[model samples]
Target: MKLRPGGFSADRVLRKFLPRSLLGRSLLIVLVPLVLLQGVALLLFYGNHLNELSRRLAGGVAGEAGFMIDEIDRAPDMRSLIIQETDRYFQFTTVFLPNQVLRHLPPPDAPGPVDDDLARALGQEMHRPFNVAWNTAPDFIRINVQMVDGVLSIDVPRKRLYIGTFYLFLIWLIGTAGLLFGISALFLRTQVRGITRLATAAEAFGMGRDPGPIKPEGAIEVRRAATAFNRMQERLRRFLAQRTIMLAGVSHDLRTPLTRLRLSLAMLPEVEPGEMAEMTGDIAEMEQLIATYLSFARGEGSEQAVPTDVAMLLEDVAAAARRAGATIEIGAPEGLTATLRPEAMRRVLTNLIDNARRHAAHVWLSAAIHGRTLRVSIEDDGPGIPTSQRETVFRPFEAASPGGTGLGLAIARDIVGAHGGDIFLFDRPGGGLRVVIELPA
Candidate 1:
């Protein structure tokens, strides 16, 4: 069905009454309609069947009262006889008020369906004006009939006007509905558990963690989704494996020819010092480019995730950069730890720090934890990349600076993405480049 305007807002409002989890939402999907159906059924039962039964009972009692009143009017001396007869046959208490005329009898303040039906039935049966006080006493329904001399008061037991079967049906309906909902909740929870498992598996896979083979279960549709997810995950793993192998083979083959050329150039004694030096420089650059390509392809190899101190990691990177003759500062909290692939994270930091050191004299490494994420930033007081070229810098072989292989940012981005994190470059406030990396803690 098509949703109206403000559909999202309506969904938000509905969510207040609804549930957030699949199990809870599924149970609601089953129970809400069932509860509503039961409510409608109860309303119909009370409105049609129960009301009809109550009216019949009320009419029977009113008829008996009319008979007693008629007999009393026919012979005033036979009042005691009529009372005794009604008491014997109808189980009603009859009181004749000869001297006291009832001035006014108030109507029921809160009349239920039974009370309204009883009143209608009594009005039709009795020609004279009368007032019915339903449940005036806990166990009796009081009827006051107006007379010229006095009032005839009839007290009928409340049980006579109640249909026992109606209450029994109500009890059965409530009990059955409760049992049905309880079963439905159990069934729904089982079915939704399958979806939860599928989601958890997908999340782990996205984060480059091994989630063992998923066993599909639950309903047909849920099973189908699980099957599809498993197939996709397997395909991704195979593709990554094939790509890694192919890159490794290509790198090895190219390095062999490059190594032979370097040896041949070194052996030649002073052929033209300038020409020799220029050729060697070009070969060195090629080797460095090859090394970068290999590093990007290998991608942190089979390293298991462990709890590592991020602050310590940043400190280590700062120390390494300092040894390389780069001025570096570190800012981080004590003992801040998170689950990470240590070797992969170290490589990412090393790349960022080296890139910063190449451009800027002063580099800053800082780490902080925010909510469920850990953020580490490498900032440098150098000529920052323009906003337009920032995204391009992450693409392979797209360098911003001279002598760079342009794979540093790409490798960093790839490693971070595998860990379900992101690396972003922003312009530092004081005209510099700031690389921000965020990972789930």
Candidate 2:
């Protein structure tokens, strides 16, 4: 189990070498088997069929050469006649080179099992000094055998040792394998495309960006998977819709009584001025509380994603903070755009800026595009939350200050998360809170 501690495991090594994409792995799946089948077929043909066929052909030629030699040795005067007779019968080009001593020659360096088989057959048939030139000519093999008086040269046609059908068979195997591989790759790519689209849609949906129903295509299983993803998207949208309608009704019903209470208080002619002021203030606060709670529950409603000028949006929030009697400094470039729900992002910016304004002497707002992310930061001179409490402050109802609903940071984080972004809390360099929201661009 621990052959080499922390080195490499068989599974890990295999995974590292394997193709990562569905299409690559799919093609490999088809390819590996096709190659193996072809290899086995080639081996069977070469080992059993072609190898034996070459040896048998080589044997026949060697036998004919031996017969001609024997005839010449028996009747030395009929040597010329024997060469002519053998050439006519065996379709060989034959000649006798007289008084030419065949000397020591280099070893055979020819390739293929055919030449080796032929050489072995020749050695067995005729026991004499001999040399075979396999590659001197394309259509012929030159065999030189040393005779008592001279050397016998026989040119055997190369066709005797080779068959044309083997080459054709090889071409057919390769061509068919390539054809099948191409067809499989074509169909596999279409199926992989369906899965890829489905995966993309899922990612966008999870990021709170809407990707409408993807087209169902490809094989039956892939199509079924695509259909399921589309159905899941529909179900989620329907559920959110139903919850929104129900929450809207609840908001209306709760506000109706408060509206009546405000109207009644306004008409009370005998009420003391100071007491009326307090009652009106309390009523307004209650209404505000109701709206905040409803907003937290609704979580920015089903707003479709669109490209918005986030720099302009930050300026608007800063202006609102100024109107609310807070001094604010702003720095953001023009045309800093990102895809997000404008209204939902508005609530996030408003909540963060307002939170900074409440306790800080001054507020700073800035927006910048960082690579593919839109980074918006709100810094203030207010006392920063403890590092330990920074994460806790985002939890619903976990108010950081007295009388604070604690839903502001929670709602802000929810909205940012829905946009496939994040909110981070950090200590400002001097002495304050630094709130940064990063959204995908």
**Number of the predicted model whose lDDT against the real structure is largest:** 2
lDDT of 2 by residue, 297-359 (tens): 998759988888878888787788789998999899888888888989889988988888888
TM-score of 2: 0.81
Per-residue lDDT over 1-441 for candidate 1, one digit per residue giving the tens place of the 0 to 100 score: 777786757667887877888888888888889889999999998888877787787778878888887887898887888888888899998787876665565766533466776777777777788888764798888888887788888898988877678778889889989999999988887898899999999887777777866989999999999999989978877887887888889998998999999999989986798998999899988988888889898886456578898888888878888898999998999999998888889999999889999999899889999999999999999999998988998999988788888899899999899889999899999989999999998
- Candidate 1 lDDT (Cα, 0 to 1): 0.85
Question: Lowest lDDT 10-mer window, candidate 1?
Answer: 103-112
Residue ranges of candidate 1 with Cα displaced over 4 Å: 1-25, 96-112, 127-129, 146-152, 224-286
Name the candidate that leads on TM-score: 1
- In order, candidate lDDTs are 0.85, 0.89
Please list the Cα RMSD from the true structure of every candidate, rounded to 1 decimal place: 3.9, 3.9
Q: After superposition, how far is residue 184 of candidate 1 from its true place, in Å?
A: 2.8
Q: Candidate 2, clashing residue pairs?
A: none
Clashes of each: 0, 0
Q: What C-alpha lDDT, on a 0 to 100 scale, does residue 102 get in candidate 2?
A: 71
